[model samples]
Target: MEVHPANEFYLQTREIATGNVVGCAGALEVVPVSQVRLPPAPVLDVHAYLADVPYTTSKEARRAVTSSQNGIRGDAGVDISDHGLTLDDEFPDEFEEGLVQEIYRRLTRTSVSDIPGPEPESLVLGNLRQFFQCQAGEIDFKWQELYGDVVRFKGPFGEDRLLVSDPKALQHIYQTSRYDFAKQAERREVSRLISGRGVLWAHGHDHQRQRKIMNPAFGPRETKAFAPLFSDVASKLGGKWKDFISQSPNQESVIDMTKWIGPATLDAMGIAAFDYEFGTLDNSDNELGNVFANMCVEVFGSLSAKDILRQALAGYLPKAIFRYIGDNAPNHRLEQLRKASAVATKVAKELIDGKVEALEVGKGKSDVMSLLVQANVSEDESTRMSEEEMIAQMRTFLLAGYETTATSLCWALLEIARHQDVQTKLRHEIHRKEREIRERGDRGLSASDFDTMPYLTAVIKESLRFHPASPSTYRETMKEDVLPLLKPITTLSGKVITELPVPKGLKVVTSINGYNRHKDVFGSDSHVYDPERWLVPGRIEKTAYVGVYGNLLSFAGGVR
Candidate 1:
């Protein structure tokens, strides 16, 4: 149960490093948890102590306001007079009477309103405009500032939703009572069109089963084994770029990274996942690759009118009816996705058949597909994934395996390119590591090598923090619960509340962006992109339920 800060969030219990699997061949030696050292907790700033100002007077009252000028324009400012409440309904004379009578009067008359939150515009086509207006990701910070960590709002689907950014509340929902909340129904229904019932879409025991079967393939030991494959593919891409530049008379070529990374990642995925070669980087024409690439652009690239309409309809329409509409409609994107799914399925089936045949001939390779098929045909019927389930997983892998990793890699490279000092330091560290490897006669970078590189780890962590692939996601509560807050908030009625009561059907959308750069947690300089923050002791806050990776919600938490 050793956990290194660099890979803690990325590696799950399912991905155990020590295992008797095909790719692994045998158990790898485990690093003791006690031997893994993390940076010390960040020290608190002097100004941090000023966070506890009482709201007993108007001057001392706190409000989260977003203003363009020095002055706020509206008359709707929070009233602090008498703690912003009216006691007109209270029986003044009776309030001073017997204790029992006064208590009864107060209980019957007093009301506690919901917590204040950001106001969205009228449902012009069902909050579509509001959703689009929040393109800059600052809305989360604004809302958290104005209304405390947990704020209530009318969601895009015309339901009361809570957008929570508090770490304690996040821990409560994600870790303590994970089963009490399920994936947002609308999103899950739509996702099934692409992912089917893969582990990404499974819940409870079903999810656990899928993870168990697939764990060996994703374990740290197996992932480290794929390092050479990654390096070889990457080196080939570098060579391609060099040739392209040489072809240009100016000794420089404009390479569209958007176009380039996809193919390179596609090749990487093909080799690493199934030992199949797409050769996309070599400019080989791959039908499945084209379909997969196009489908990604159509679904996850941007939000068009068609996408917005389809998403809005998903909230109301039944999955079957909506799918029928998608199938029959004149939407080009929808049609492409359907074709893509068909192609992906056909390819997955062929690959699995090949692996099975290889196994029969006693020539099985140690790729993910072979190991998965091996696990499938074994005696453990309950843990084995059916053919359909395996295909669904294949689809998930194709989409998730390449796109997000490529995006993160791009961001990391961009950041390194922009910061010369950071780049120089990283290069020096790389040289040092190379020297050590050469001296030790190590063939390639190992898991231990990755663990020891602090600068490289910091760069990757900073990139992930700066730009999480999924900025926000929704969850619907299935059971009533109370969320504890790290910071207490004063309500409009002047009453201080430490816990919030969440209804069974309440919708919660967590802001990963906001939490990553939380001022209170990460200090006032949280918004800045400084990799040095990771080196500085006490710069990052300790959070109870901060996702899977090093207190970052980038990869999300819970079973995911």
Candidate 2:
């Protein structure tokens, strides 16, 4: 059952076959059951709903809001809060007021409804952008801005999906009712394409079992041990880049980070995760590296209409149907996926075989895959994963450890390249820290030393905040539930709702971009790439636990 934000907390009943966005209490809009025609799409009147609302507790964000000409709502030439943030004194300008009543007149006509979520005026076409942005674009935050925190948008064939960003709402989805929600059938089917029935693909009890068996491998001891291994791989990458730079004219080269970073992360993952050496950084023409890189290109790089349609329409079918489609499809993207999946499976099997052989001959291995193998050889059958499941886990880990990490490094480098000041500051910090450490008789930075450098840590956090590699995730409700809200929302009938009523079988989307750049959470400049916010004391106060790392949705929280 795919659960949407409107359903988990804000239970909604939509007429999906028709174009009707049926409202339920606390979900979209509390609409009374009636045959009513929707009027013309009114002009954007953000001021009406957001009037006199405090944007953030962060002093920096408040300052940004006050300094802006049009204030928080971005109404261009209109000054919303002239004397600065006092509720009773501040009001939307006359031009803004006319805009509000006009919208109110147009909206109030619709009777009471539930889940009074702000929806796109252009309907299905409008929601298409939300899908794109949620995957890997920048425009999805606009939906959150236009709608309240919990937004209802159409997916393939006008299927309702609630893009949830509200902190309290996300808490329920991620923590309070986590087990109550399951992976959408489409997501699971798609996961099988690349990762098979790995931890990433499994849901419910299967997910719990896999995660419990594998989580211990990534504990503090393994993580700390992996650090020096990562540094060595990074040094190999740097050494290769230095050679490239030396060969160029003027001792300078335009090294494409994309070409280099993917392999570097692959090498790092190889040694750290499986104790397998890919040697991709050392050899530019590494065959396995090229295969994975080509796989990525075919999957994410190409922008053909066929690819886009396939990605958008991915959720339209279940696993059995998707399997039929994959087997029978005549063309490119699916074939590319199949090829990559085969290669990944083959690689996983080899790694598993090596580990099994090593363990049999009394050689102990400590890598993640080895750990799983150890569990499989355990006397307890409950702790063991099936052979296919083990292969899937390896495939999942390889892709995650290679592609996502590589993409993140590229994004971080891009940000550094764009901002010379940040680059310079970071460079100075690295050199200064190295010199300081040498003076203390230390050779170089340790795993712990990385933490001592504030600017470097800040930059990494900010980068993750801005560009989460996997920007969106989905869930479906298993049972009827109600969602509590951190912020109350107003319905079409002028009533305010705090908690939402939810029913089972609704599709929901958790937007990493929307939450990371939430105005209330990170201040008005949340959209801006300002690492200084992390330095400031009161910039981001507190919220529900959002991430497993650096307070980011980039590393999602809760169980798998």
Candidate 3:
């Protein structure tokens, strides 16, 4: 038998040389059978040896070893050198074969299909432009066709290469906590236009510090204190809607609930978070409130010339000029943004300064803003926010409390309206809880009360999952490395097969809508609005697989 040199290591074993040899009295001593003639050895090749192995190749061998050590497999293979044979010669059992086949099937099933043949770069760019211009309703279908579930394109206005609609890949992306991924420059510009350099746009330590200071504002006690405020605002808005509907006889007046709720929630945020009022709930045209509302409408309405110019000179222009142009463009809408930011900031400053003065004067105040002021001033270390930082923190709280919650509520209502059964179920749950609280003589529902309403909470959760207002998030890879996507992908031209090689500086845009509706993870009815799915007794397995936004990508992932 010709021995391959590679197998020489396995062949030269003590057991094969001598069955038993006495060392001194009864002790066994290993002896080499040098005189024994061995068959001429065959040249050993690592590639050939690896090819003959049960795993197909050494790459698979390495993967198996890694997986086994990581507890991803049950057992290590048995040693065969003692039996004068190599482990690679042994065949796998039928069960093991079936298991391997099943795993491969599952993996192949989830693998991303090759992107169709590479068209002209201009074609891709044109498609993207058309996509951006498309109505919200038309976007989903068009996106699905262009890139079935995983698509990558370079940013139209920046250095970022964007990846769209790969949930498992998104999960891995969001797991990193280094704050390396951040809002794109365009998004930052937009946020600044709306909320200044607040927590929404802050990075690193500054963001953490701001979040700490702002925590108390959203604390259970603080949030519950604002429950009456929320009820008041909701009631007022409800009454206005009722009156408007009553006045419109015969023909129904089609109000954009989206437009109506923006101001109402703005009013709620002012009163609940800052102990002030936008007076939007009272139907009063408060200048600040009107300016803020108009700014939001205008900013979102159409891309301004300044926006176009900023996009054109993304990396070339100085940051200051970009911000200035964004804040003070030639358009009146831009002027409105500036005015809104100025007015809101001025009001926040006044509130903080007044609370500080009142506290110094021995007067007492216990609202969220007052508490924040107290906290901000009392720390020896790690407790201080600069006046500017305080302003940013307050602005963040205002935006977070107002915009996010209101958007969530709006989507929830819209979903509930469309699915009457779900609406009825949620209403029943809410009414039941309210009745319980009333019977127990609790004057108002607390944060804990909200927690206890499982069905209501589920409905909110489901709506958030379905219609996340910010449907996509952007990130830039900070380091150069091969990023193996959770799902493997074949290239459009069939030249390259990869999971996804996300090069450094590539911009990655995660699609919350796609991930939330992933069929593999969430099942066939993933697209449907079904709060009942979350109401099961135990934790939902599918939801646990989510990597962003507390296992959902509704909220922006990472620090920001």
Candidate 4:
């Protein structure tokens, strides 16, 4: 059942729906039941209410109050002494208090609420420049300038949307009350069209079931076993690059790493994810590679107005109309992507069938699909996934695992190229590791050897922090929630809020970019990409939420 935000007066009568938590409606004001048409509670010992409360040391509670006051209440537990933050000082200069007044007066008779954010210049057509900036790769600077830790604005559909950068609030959203917020429906729909009913687009129980079956294959042992495949694919790409450079008269070919990275990662994914070989590094016309490459060009390359219109409105169109247009329209790119999807679908089905047969014969391979099949067959009938579900999982992993890793590596290399000192230091570390390995009479560097190189690990973490593969992720609140603030914020009305009461159906954008560079959490140099900070003791501070691999939100936290 979906839960909605409601007033506190209804709390006694309102039952929280199964799998949902109702949001506190007017807790910001904490109005009494007597004022809301309910009989006042008998004035007995109010102290009894506190009797069963969990034990919290006064010092800890004081620290919490100091660090995180939303200003709605005075007793919000936060450690203010360490924060050195002020909400009034943080409000963007562009925000106009008069705009909120005008909005409440002219648009709706509802009471105006407090949150520090600039009223967009135009309500109906909100932030068109944001779309253009995202396309042009100039979004981070604009977002940083337009708002501080949190921003609220009218969305394109005239609904309220929020972009939050606060780490504490983010922890609640991503981990504490994760189920209360879900991936945006529209985004999930689009992903579903592209990748079937896979883990990427799955929600609730289906997602949990899929992840449970798939997680072990991606665990440390399997990942280490696949290391050689990665090295082989990377070496093949490097050898090709070397040959291309040597052929040039200047002995330095200007190659587009982006072009090479895709094929290399695809080949790696082929072996790692499915135990298949693409041989994409040696063959430009490799069927799956060509399909993917062509699809990328068709989607991202210059498009005619008609194609653009069709793509933009595809989400809103009926399923039949959308599929008809896709199948019959003059969209070469869409056709290629469709073909790639079809290919993936076919290959996944075949692989799963083969894995099932292999497992029956007690000769399963260590590839992800085989391990998953083995687990599925071993589990109880209730826990087993359908064959179609297995196929969907393969398609999801094939695309996501390779594409995201390749893009991140490309970004890391680009940063290394930009910073000569970092590159040199990294090279030295690699050489030192190689020497140590040779002295130990090892054939090559093992996963353990790689772990010994602190500098490389630092560089990768720094790169991920600076250039997260997914810059932003969207969520829609399924229930109203009270967001705890690490730093108290001053609302437009000048009231200090201790906790933010969010309305249901609210759209939120979690900025991975913004969180990675949060000032209070990471200190003044958060924006700077100095990997050596990781080497310094206590320089890399931990946050309320650490993501999947690192404290950074690059991989997001919880289920992701």
TM-score against truth, every candidate: 0.76, 0.77, 0.70, 0.75
TM-score-based ranking, best first?
A: 2, 1, 4, 3
Each candidate structure's count of clashing pairs: 7, 31, 3, 23
Which stretches in model 2 have alpha-carbon errors above 4 Å?
1-126, 133-137, 300-318
Candidate 3 lands at a TM-score of 0.70
- Go through the candidates in order and give the C-alpha RMSD of each one to the true structure: 19.5, 14.9, 13.8, 12.2
Per-model lDDT: 0.67, 0.69, 0.58, 0.65
Better of 1 and 2 by lDDT: 2
lDDT of 2 by residue, 1-560 (tens): 21111111111234424333333322233222132222222342344333211122233333443353122222232222332322221334443344433332322222223344545434434355545534463555766777678776765554556778888888787778867767777677768877888888888788888888888888877787787788888887889889989999999988888988888988889888899997888787876687788466566563544454566576666667777886668767668777778888888889999999999998967778888888777777668888888888898977655788898899999999999999999999999988988999976578787878999999999999999887778788788677778888675556677876555777778878888888788888998898888989889857777677866788777775
Residues 456-519 of candidate 3 have per-residue lDDT tens digits of 7788778887888666776666664334454555554443444554434455667777776666
Candidate 2's TM-score: 0.77
Candidate 3 has which clashing residue pairs, if any?
114-490, 115-492, 161-507
Better of 2 and 3 by lDDT: 2
Q: Find the 10 residues in a row with the least total lDDT in model 3.
A: 20-29
| TM-score of candidate 4 to 2 decimals | 0.75
Point out the higher-scoring one by lDDT: 3 or 4: 4
Query: lDDT tens digits, residues 1-560, model 1?
Result: 22222211110011223221111112112333345443322342313211111111111111211121122111122222232232222424232223223222222221112466656555534444555446535778777777878777765544557778888888887888867777877767555667678877788888888888887788777888877888788888989899989999889877777667778888888898899887887764777667766466566555765566666557677768776776677767667767776787888899899889999999887777887788778788777888888888887777666777777777788888889999999999989999999999986777678789999889888989888877777788888677888888676556577877665767688888878878777778988888888888998878675688878888888875
* Model 4 collision count: 23
Can you tell me which runs of candidate 3 are displaced by over 4 Å?
1-127, 137-149, 157-160, 239-256, 302-312, 362-368, 375-381, 399-401, 481-484, 492-499, 536-540, 543-550
Q: Cα lDDT for residue 289, model 4?
A: 69
Q: Which stretches of candidate 4 lie over 4 Å from their true place?
A: 1-113, 128-132, 135-141, 294-337, 375-379
